[model samples]
Target: MSAFVVAYFPHLCLAFGGLLVLCLSMARSVPAGFYPVTAGLFAALPGLWAVAGPQGGSPIACFYAGLLSVIALATIGLLARYAKRRGFAGDALYGLLLWSALGMLLLADADDWIMLAVGLELASLCLYALIAARLDDNLGTEAALKYFLPGAMALAVLLFGMALIYAASGSLEIAASLAAPGPLTAAGLALVLIGVGFKLSLAPVHLWTPDVYQGAPAPVAAFLSSGSKAAAAAALLHVCSEVSPEAKELLWPALAVAAGLTMAVGNLGAVAQGSVKRLLAYSSIAQMGYILMAAMAVNDGGGEAALFYLAAFALMDLAAFGAVGALSAEIGDRDDIAAYRGLGYVHPWRAGVLAIGLASLAGLPPTAGFVGKFLVFGAALSAGYVGLAAFGIITAVVGVFYALRLLAALYMRESLIAHPAAVYATGPAATLALGVMAAGLVGLGLFPQTLLGTIAALFGGA
Candidate 1:
């Protein structure tokens, strides 16, 4: 029991913290500033655990859990600020964020099918509520419905796949399922991949991402793009790590095709979007495609590359969305890319942060995103997926054109209409958040050796 507690302490802290916050939210006449303080404390708990908690799993599991904890805390801090600015009251939202973070932690440490499925459902349900928390917005409600329907279908498919695997292997352990080979097992793996593919927004099944991101609140969209997507990618890595050589022959080719198509479709789709939020949504799809190349590699080096890239993507993407949220509050039109015309002249700090984010997203030099892409492509090439690596490079170049469009609007174009009365207003909290993330992105890009060495150790142990 002590060992178990040591291994799973991060999950326990988040779960207990969530329940405590939920209880506090039910009390009447709470103090004015209690929730934010409590939120800071809750966020701190995970970071502390990441440093001090006992590590008992495989090196990959430990690395993923630590990374997930850090990302979750960063996301929660950003969401708390966004929620406060939006006049969202009560501790309920914070509690749900903690709950979702706990679910993600569970997924990171999951060693068996049951735990993975449980974590997936828990995180999905909490996100459904979070997306629709703004009940007054019809678009929010509609996006929630759209997200829920597909999520529910994916959950069902995942459960069915697990059941089939159990029947074939007579065991529910992930490694055991992989070791026991049969036609049923292969079919089950295919079904499971399909389900996870939807969550990760792989092409063909990625139809829901843009509409949902465009409709949901910007902070919620940020969480979906960063923390939630990272968790799903970790789960994919966990399952794929156990694949047999024969299974790899089939799975690798399928993943390669999916990665190629996802990159192509995502970049092409982003080129046509008029909404900043929608464009970022499409950009995330392409980012996921790059990460999937690492997944396709399915080795220690690949896992390291995937983990590093996910961390980089989370910071840069969150910074981008944070800038968007701040500007949306001022402009009142979250969807219009045109609203950002001449923003660089008017709001240099915010524009600079957004530019850094977009540059990183485009894989420009001296940014973590560029390092991540290099590692991911290297992993693919080393794993003998040279064709996929070449295709990913081509699509990444295509992505730059769309990312630059937003920058062009920010710096080059003149505003077609008069500015709103609130156009100059800025949220200090959001700005601070973006500044922190932007700094982190630059720091990682310039000094990546520390992180790379840490990842190398973890992968070596795995």
Candidate 2:
């Protein structure tokens, strides 16, 4: 029990921390800045996994779980400022965030079917509520409904797939079930892929992402794009890595097609967006395609590439969305591209942070995103996925155009807003959080070896 608690300390903190925040809400007078402080504490609690005792969980899961915590902490930092301004920084929102983080951590460590199912539901439900937390916002509520209904269908399909796989293999372990070769297993894996595809916002099933991201609060969108998607990607990586060669042969072509389509759709979608949030939403979708492309080459260093990209992708989205959350106009988010004209002149620091994020997203040099792409493309080529790598490169170049559009809006154009001062200035806490993301992007880009080496070492690559 002691070891179990130690192993799952991060999980425990998220679960209990959520309840504690809800309890605190009943107090007559609570400390100012309490929620963010509490959130910071919860985020820090996961570090105890290394310090307090023996590590009890899979190292990969622990790493991903810790990453999720950081994402949640950053979301809260932005929320600390964004929510209050929008009149929705209730204790309930904070509590839900912790609980949702709990689910993400659970998914990171889930080695069996039931645990995976539970984590998926917990995370999805909490996300629905978080999206609609702004009771008065019709768009938020509508986005929640769109996500919730489709999500429910996806979960049902996933559970059914699990059932079929279990029946075929008589095993609950992810690897064991997937390793079984049969008609049942083939069908089951296909269904499961469909479910995961929807969850990950893959092309053809990604219709929900842009509207939802546009409707959800910017900070919540940040969490959705970064933490939730990272968790899903981690789980899918585990699934892909476990498949039998027969299973791989069955699903390989489908996955490759999806990867290409997702990249094309996402980049093309971004090019048409007039709203920054929608553009970021599309960009996030495109990043997932790159992950997929790298994942196909897991044996040839693609797993490490995917892991590095996931980490880099999360930081990039957080910085981008957090910047948007910080710079909302008098009424709400400045979603329109025209709204950000001359933002660099008015808020140099915030705009610069956004530029770093976009540059990274564009896979430009001296940014984490660029390093991530290099690793991904290298892995793809090493695995003999030459055509896919070339396609990804082309899509990446296309992706740069939209990011540059946003960058031009920030610095080149004159301020369109009459009262630049009226725009919500980012609070210190949120600014600091965005700074961390920007620094991480550049730091990882410049020193890619540390992370690449660490991932390789963890997976016994070197």
All candidates: TM-score: 0.95, 0.97
Candidate 1: worst 10 consecutive residues by lDDT? Answer: 420-429
List runs of model 1 lying over 4 Å from the truth: 418-429
| Tens digit of per-residue lDDT, candidate 1, span 1-462 | 988777666677778888888888888788745765575576566556556534664565566566655555555556665666677654787788778877876676678889988888788888888888887778888998999999889888988988898998998899888887778888888888888888899987899999899887787788788878888898898888888777777767888899999999999999999989889999999999998889988674688789889889988888888778767766665468888888777777777888898989889879999999999999999988899999999999999998799999989999765655445445554556687789988988998877888776666632
lDDT of 2 by residue, 1-462 (tens): 987877778888888998898888888598747977886788668755533322767767766865776798799889988888778878778888888888887776789989888988899999999999999999999999989999999899999999999999999999888877988998898888788778789988899999999999999999989988898888888888888888888888999999999999999899999999999999999999999888788866799889999999999999998888777744246689998888887778888899999999989999999999999999999988899889999999999999999999999998766644545667888988999999999999999998787676656677
Report, for every candidate in turn, its global Cα lDDT versus the true structure: 0.80, 0.86
Off by over 4 Å in 2: 48-54, 330-332
By TM-score, the best candidate is 2
What TM-score would candidate 2 get against the native? 0.97
